[model samples]
Target: MLSHTRKNKILEILKRHKQISTQELEKQLSVSGATIRNDLTQLEEKGLIKRIHGGAVLPERESKNSFRSFHKRSEKNVEEKKAIGKVAKNYIENGQTIILDASSTVLYLLPYLTQYEKLTVITNGIYTALELKNEEDFNVILLGGIVRPKSGSVEGLIGSCMLNDISANLMITSAHGFNVKNGLTDFNFYEVELKKKMVEKSDRLIAVLDHTKIGHTSAAQFASSSEIDLLITDSQINDKDLKEIKDSGIEIIIGK
Candidate 1:
């Protein structure tokens, strides 16, 4: 196993117990004394934890480190996101109006989209606009509104007004969470409203979610399970959760 994997496990244990000794971690993780010491040192350097005598514990100011940027999140889950992006591309057609949501997965589609011509793309994502800015054939429309750097999308009245005029052939979107109870949810209220508007204006709504999003929920409710027309996810998704979503009449596409 990777050293980082061991470090993560040690951190999890420390998070639960607040503090632990090197001997206790060695016994629980079945690692050598040298390995435990190395991990503790590395964790301390990373600022995720602090060494206490023989063991390490989670940082004292954990709340300050909770928020992260979208750019950082984009690098993670790359394989799954690329797989979903490839499958989602199959739904696109030449000369079609496609609304690409502000998602890391949808951003992956830009590299593949150069093959198409005369397609009109609408979006609120700054990153997506910048990615496709050089492509000559595709007509790009960026919605103007309050920009949220963390989410990397536009929000507020201006964004809503922009969506009102445009109707897309397909609305390709992603979510922060996907649960049976909440369906699709986001952490931000304005984002929740903007997503709902996008769903409403599209002829068909396609949701691209990584395996991590399944059965998870956030604070804001945007739409229910029945609203989506299709869901594209990775092959590692649980069969039972896949069945539940598929049984609701939403087509499920699993990419390996």
Candidate 2:
């Protein structure tokens, strides 16, 4: 396997076992002891693991703000995000006004949006607005604010004020992490504020979360489970946590 793919496999194994020996990794991965050692060293340098005499262990705990940039995240779960975006499109109707958040997952909606004959899309995602620029049937409004270069998302007071002035029939958003307790949480404070405003100005709020985000908590809580009108996620979500979220009364739509 490629080095990055091997490292990701190691991470998956570590997540399940908490720790794994170099000898075991070599046996499992069909690689040499030296290769396992090298992977462990790299993972340790990334603060994802702690090296021991013969193995590596997961870090004591991950930081709440341990979020990847938009580019990085966009590559992580492409298939799941595409499935989610396709399902999310079903909620939109022609001639309706909608708010789309500045999330990599939300970007997948661009292709499916062609079904709409006429739509008004308001967004803070720089790339999202640009993606719709060529669609003559859509009226796209790009919100104004401080642009977060890492995520290409517009935020801060200016964007929040702009969101407050407009109301949408529906709002589609994604979060850094989510759980029953924290609901929809994110790493960026400014993005969190803007998302809260989007929630306030929309008639219905739909959180499009991939399975990876389920049961995870981030630095800032934007909306509680009770506050969300719907949640669209992939079918790989854990049954236990899914039950808890369903029990909380939030409607769930599982994407294939």
Candidate 3:
């Protein structure tokens, strides 16, 4: 088959299954593994798909309406987020002030915060604040702002003003989608504004993202890759993409 025809067929398969492995594509396309890999690479360059460990998945839709509610997002990539949370805890030292964004990925860090003897967490996530209410050793400061019901997050001028006065040792955040060019992007304008404030006031910024978000670009760009101190993602991230991100000078920690 012609290379263009083969690549088109591969895109059709990915559109149908959302994700397909190299081996499976090889079998279906009747092509060698190297050829399939090349096809995946070319498609990825076009921003059509994101290559994972052994497969490729469709890139996230670049629509603001594609944003899911907090509870709904929590259900997706559960294992990977859990693993990221475990590794994220290693960056925290006892009695340090930290900023946690309202992203579901940051919510996973709540359980791990118990390991610290004394820690203060400032966040805009209502659910996150409620969860930390029971931890005696931890001080949870829920930011005051307009509540975004969809994300269970607080944002607006109030939150931005509050953040201006607060300085944190670290900030843990997540994005709707991120890529080398856009860095970190989100669908909501208010959330993006608040995240910008958080990034500015924190000494270090750590972005916790799943593999699906790696090569995608969302509606609103917030923090650039250069602004982030580190990025924590699942092991499923493609080697080439990971190398490119690392080459950009951002530290990456793979969560097993």
- Candidate 3 TM-score over all chains jointly: 0.74
Q: Over the stretch 88-174, how does candidate 2's per-residue lDDT look in tens digits?
A: 999999999999998989999789999898899999999999999999989999999888676788987888887767889999999
Question: Against the hidden reference, what TM-scores do the models get?
Answer: 0.73, 0.74, 0.74
Alpha-carbon lDDT of model 3: 0.85
For model 2, the stretches where C-alpha displacement exceeds 4 angstroms are 1-67
Q: Report RMSD for candidate 2.
A: 11.6
- Tens-place lDDT per residue, model 1, 111-207, is 7787788889999899898898887888899888889776588876788888888889999998878977679876555667788888888999888
Task: Estimate the Cα RMSD of every predicted model relative to the unseen true structure.
Answer: 12.5, 11.6, 12.4
State in Å the error of residue 32, model 2.
52
Candidate 3 residue 121 Cα shift, in angstroms, is: 0.5
Query: After aligning candidate 2 to the native by TM-score, how far in Å is the CA of 112 from where it should be?
Result: 0.4
Q: How well is each residue in 1-256 modelled by candidate 3, as lDDT tens digits? A: 8775677677657655878899999999999999999878876765566899998987775112244577988888999999999999999999999999888898888899988978989999999999899999988899888887877999877888888788899999989788888899875556777888988999999999999889888545679988988999999999988999988988999999
Select the stronger candidate by lDDT from 1 and 3.
3
Candidate 2 residue pairs in backbone clash = none
